[model samples]
Target: MPDKPRVILDSKQLELTINRLCYQLIENHDDFANSAIVGLQPRGVYVSKRIHEELAKMTGNKNIRHGALDATFFRDDFRTRETPRIPDVTELNFNVENLKVILVDDVLFTGRSVRASMDALLAFGRPQLVELLVLIDRRYTRHLPIMPNYTGKMVNTSLSERVSVEWKETEGKDCVKLHTVKK
Candidate 1:
């Protein structure tokens, strides 16, 4: 049987969190005139898309640049993984040079993903500033030094636990769950 999932953020709460994150983004990058939002591909895109939509609505700037970044090749343990790694599509088409880039992701785990994302982003262009935005921040589990500039939730999880974020656009609903393996 599958392990029971502990509810972290339900649909209502998820919407609130997204809205809050969007407001926070607006607070920092007012009109996004000199900024862009890039979602770390695969899962981050879901969260990023929501933020992009809401922020655009809030700022009335539909021209705000949004892109997708795939960091599979940039991961440190790509070759070490038992399963073969397949890279996702990268759809960045704007110049990131001298702009403030916000990197959005679904879950902040070991900080390795953020590190790989930074490396991947550098290939596009050198930004004046880079900030992180995550739906869930898994605290005390980072292997590298990294933190999110805007966070929806802060969860303290054990090494054996897993944090999964589901979005309505893809998962049929929005929710954050903590899954513990059955012992």
Candidate 2:
């Protein structure tokens, strides 16, 4: 097993960020009533669910659609790994054709994952627009120009540093961490 990294965003900050993001999403989109939140599997899924719940509370309606997307197969580096993990099925019950789709993720790193996610999402249906929402935006060496429309926070770090996001679905905790690999 590999060594885990350091802790960055604690429980308090995580909750605060989520609330702020929820408000931002509501404020930015005038037609949020017809919007759908799609979370990238693993951490993104959890974050999306939380936001969905918050939106429902604020709007006093439970019609918000939440979807989970797994983009492992769509990754450009998929074939490079010796043993790649099989991707989970992408589940978007509603048609994305003319609806607003919000893509949620835990961390924004090289932007490769976001790029791959977009490719995977296109297979479902062409949406009117797609916005990115990320918990932590660690601006490092980005190969693509992808940017998050709703970002919780921005942290600067070296190429060797890593940002880990943990949620109840996977880690049974809600927090974000920053760690550096041992040289």
Give the best candidate by TM-score: 1
Model 1, 59-168: lDDT tens digits are 88899999999998899997788997889999998999999999999999999989999999999889999999999999989998898999999999988899999877
* Worst 10 contiguous positions by lDDT, candidate 2: 1-10
Give lDDT tens digits, candidate 2, residues 69-163: 99988899967889887887688998988888999998888999999999998998889999999988988767899989999989897887888
Clashes of each: 0, 1
Count of backbone collisions in candidate 1: 0
lDDT, each prediction: 0.92, 0.86
> Residue 118: error of model 1 in Å?
0.3
* Residue 84 error, candidate 2, Å: 3.4
Q: Kindly report which residue stretches of model 1 are placed more than 4 angstroms away from their true locations once superposed.
A: none
Q: For residue 59, give model 1's deviation from the true position in Å.
A: 1.3
Instruction: Write out the backbone clash pairs for model 1.
Output: none
How far in Å is the alpha carbon of 141 misplaced in model 1? 0.9
